[model samples]
Every structure is written in structure tokens, then in C-alpha cells.
Target: KVQESARVSGILHDIGKLVLLEFPDFFKKAKLNKQGRITQDSEYAVLGTSHSEIGGYLLGMWGLPNEIVEAITFHHRPSIQISTKPDLLTVLHTANGLANMCLMEMESDFGTYLDMKYLDAIGVSGYLDEWLSITHQVLDNTDNDQVQT
Candidate 1:
């Protein structure tokens, strides 16, 4: 059940990226490099709105539950105080971290940087290393499959 909620949270987390459509130059500038690399410098030089915050705003506009909105809003900054402790938010936070790590390894232009306070708030610090390892394994498996195909 929590996983399902988290799935919803993940789906809504990046909804703010849609707002970037308003800034074509910024969007183009933020494109991943040919090698699929993104850096803090590139982001600052490109689109101004980070996807994490945008997603939260989108969720709020859609009238989602406050807990859901908080999850979406604070997934990147989980240290922020929220009215409720939603398990879904924690799940989204962990999943986002894992996904960011995977995307970084894949050389995706999109970068993931979250506050460490989020991990402590979620009570899942020990799982980070494990999740990172699993993310690599998953990437390797996908790469192997692609090579075989």
C-alpha cells in the first residue's frame, strides 16, 4: 500500500518539469550533453526551475492531499517540517534518491541532489548503500540485456 502511494508520489514529483515548457531557451540549454552529463553549473546556466519544486507546485495546483503535496514538495528536502508523516513521502524520497543515482550512472543530463536530512527524517539511512548497490545491479542487468539483444 505504501509502495503504491509512493508510486503516485513519484509520478507527481516531476510534474513541475512541465513548466519549463514556458522557457524554450532555458529548456534547450538544460539539455543533457552528448555524453549525457549534467552539472550544477549547467543547471544554473539553463532552466531556472528545478523539477523537484515544480512537481510540488503542480501537485498543489491539482488539489492533491496535503500529505501527497508535502511528499512531492519535500522529497528533495525531507528535512522540512510537515504536518503529517506520510509513508508515501518517505518512499518517494528513497525512490528518488535511487533513481537519481541510476540516472547519474547512466550519464543522464538530469541531476539529483537531495539533502541528507531527508534520510534521517525517513529513518532509512542504512538502506541508502543497499539501494545504491541494487540500482547498479539493475543498471548492469539492463545493459547486459541490451548487449544480448
Candidate 2:
């Protein structure tokens, strides 16, 4: 039950990124250079809304569970007062951090910062290796299956 909410939270975590597509200049400015680097300014600054908040707003509009909505909205700042325990938000926080780290290495234009305090608050300090391993395994599984398609 809780895990399901967490999964949903993860899926909806980036819902705000969709809005960035609406502004070509902002979206293009958010892109990384050929070498995959960005300056202090982010594309979101131009769009005027962060992905977390945008995702939360959309989820709320969709009539998702309050917990799910909170998890999606506050995953970036789990310390904020929400109705549920830190579990679902923690999962999302960690997943988002790991995903951001991966994208950073890939030179993705994603400009969000992964808050270390969120990881600590979620008690996920030691699980990074396992999380990354699982992520790679899932990616490999999908890649392998792609050949079949």
C-alpha cells in the first residue's frame, strides 16, 4: 500500500517538467552544453515554477490521494509539514537524488539540485550503492527487452 504510493509518487515526480516544454526558450536554455555543463542560472528560473511544485499541483488536480500528492509535492523538501510519515517522500527524495546524479554525469539539462538534507532526513545515507545497482539493472533489463521490440 505505502510502496504503491511511493511508486506513484516517483512516476509523478517530474510532472512539472512537462510544463517546461511549453516554453521553448526556457526549455532550450535549460539544456546542457555539448559538454553537459550549466551555469548558476537554471532554465526553471525563466519558467517561474519548479518541477516539484508543478507536479504536485497537477497531481492534486488529478484527485490523487493526499499522501500521494504530498509525496510528489514535497519530495524535494520532505521537511515541510505533510500529513504522512517521511516514508513515501523519502523514497522519492532518494530516487530523485540518484536520478539527478545520473543525469549530471550524462550532461542532461536537468538543473535541479538534490538536497543532501532530504537524503539524511529520509535515512537513506547508506543505500546509494544498492539504489544505483538496481537502477542499472532495471535499465539493462529495459535495454535487453528493446531488442525484442
Candidate 3:
């Protein structure tokens, strides 16, 4: 169950971007000054909606589970999500940040590559090292045979 949740969360995390690109008219007036990088403020100001919100709404309409929808909705800044207990959304947010830190180099609108505040809020800040260690172990074990395409 945990593995499936992680898989679904990973697959749907950036689905909002697809929603935005598929419906350009919705963001037709959105400015390109930010190089199409839509942070919370920029997206709300220019497009009148963020991709996260759109994706969440679409997923809900499509009858996806609430946990998955919520995770995708607040994946960017889990601190903004309501709820004290750690949930799938929290995991997604942490994983998303870690993945971003590993993969992206471009200067982002939001300050840090990861949201430590969110991690701290969920009381998992102390476990980050363990997570990273596992991440490194996984990467070290991967082989070219893992790539299908």
C-alpha cells in the first residue's frame, strides 16, 4: 500500500503542469516574464489560478482518492496545507523537494530547493539524513538495465 501511494503520488505530482499546458486559454493572459515558471503568487496574479489547484480540481472530478488529490494540490508548499498529522501529502512534499534538489539547477521563484519548514512542521526533520542515505543507496544500486527507453 505504501509503495502504491508513493507511485501514484510521484506520477501525479506534476500533472497540474500538464493541465495548464493543455488548456492554454485558461492562462492565455499569463505573463512570460517569469519564463513560464509559475510560483503561487505569479500564477494567481497572471493566470488567476495555480497549476496545483487546477490539477487537484481535475483529479477530484476524475474521482481520484482525496489523499492523492490533496498531495498534488499542495506539493509545492506543504506548509500551506492544513493538518497537523503527517500524511501522504507530507511525504510527497518532502520527496518532491529532495527530487528537485537532486535534479534541477535553474533558479526557482521560491527560495530553497526544499521546504524545511514543512519537514519541521511534520516532525520529520530529524529523519532527513536517513532518507537521504536511503536515496543514495538506491541510486548507487541502479544499473543501465533499469532504463526501458
Candidate 4:
């Protein structure tokens, strides 16, 4: 059940970007003025709320599970979560950050980073190295699995 929740949350986490696309002017301003800053901060500055929050709200309105809603809502800043116990939210947050770290360009200023404090609070900080190793291995396998034209 937990894994399913995480999977669903991951799939839906970026749904708000579609909604935000309706306001191209806001995105243009955010990109121009909010370089080198966290994406959620720029989004909030331009749209009055972050995509995570918007996605969460939409999920909630659609009657999705609260776990999925909260996971998507606070994946960018899990330290702000009310519960310190590791759960679906924690998994989603950590996985999202790690994926971003691996896939994003080095020179990009997207500001994707792990919340170590949150992981420490949940007693999961010790697993980061192992998780990163597994991430890299999975990425390697994925690259090898691709069919070249």
C-alpha cells in the first residue's frame, strides 16, 4: 500500500505544472528574476503558491488520498511536514530530490537538494549513501537498456 501511494504521488507530483502553464507570463518572470533560487520560491513569488501546493490542492479536491496529497504538496520541503516519522511523504521527497540531483545539469540553478535535517529527524540519514548508490546503479541499467536507433 505504501509503495502504491508513493508511485501514485510520484506520478502526480508535477501535475500542477500543467495548470501553471496557463500563466506563461508568470513563468517568464519567474525564470528571469528567480534564477539561482529554489523553484518553489520563485513559483510562489510569481503565482502566489508553489506547484506542489497547487497539485496537492487539486488532488484533494479530486478526493485522492491525503497521504498522496501531502506527499506531493511538501515533496520539495519535507522538513515542513507535521509528522517526523518516515512515511510515503518521506520516500517521495527523498526520491524526488535524488532523481533531480542525478538528472539535472550541473550548471543549472534549479536548487534541488535533500532536506538532511528531515531525514535525520526520521532516523534515515544513514541510508543516503546506500540509496544514492542504488540510484546510480538503476540509472546505469536504464542507460544500457535503451535501444539505439
Best by TM-score: 4
State which candidate, 3 or 4, has the greater lDDT.
4
Candidate that would win on lDDT: 4
lDDT string, candidate 3, 98-143, tens digits: 5444334332322364577777776887877676656446645765
Instruction: List candidate 1 stretches off by more than 4 Å.
Output: 28-49, 82-86, 106-112, 137-149
Cα lDDT of model 4 by residue, 32-126, tens digit: 32234437778877788998999899999999998899999998888888776889988888777766665543322223368877888999878
* Model 2 quality (TM-score): 0.68
- Model 1: weakest 10-residue lDDT segment is 106-115
lDDT of 4: 0.76
- What is candidate 4's CA lDDT for residue 108? 27
Query: What C-alpha lDDT does candidate 2 achieve relative to the native structure?
Result: 0.63
Alpha-carbon shift of residue 55 in model 2 (angstroms): 1.6
TM-score sort, best first: 4, 3, 2, 1
Model 4 vs truth, CA RMSD? 4.6
Superposition error at 48 for model 3 (Å):
2.4
CA lDDT of each prediction against the hidden true structure: 0.62, 0.63, 0.69, 0.76
Clashing pairs in 3: none
RMSD of 2: 5.3
- lDDT, candidate 1, 3-84, per-residue tens: 6666677677766656666767775567576546444346556655466667777778888877788888767667665523
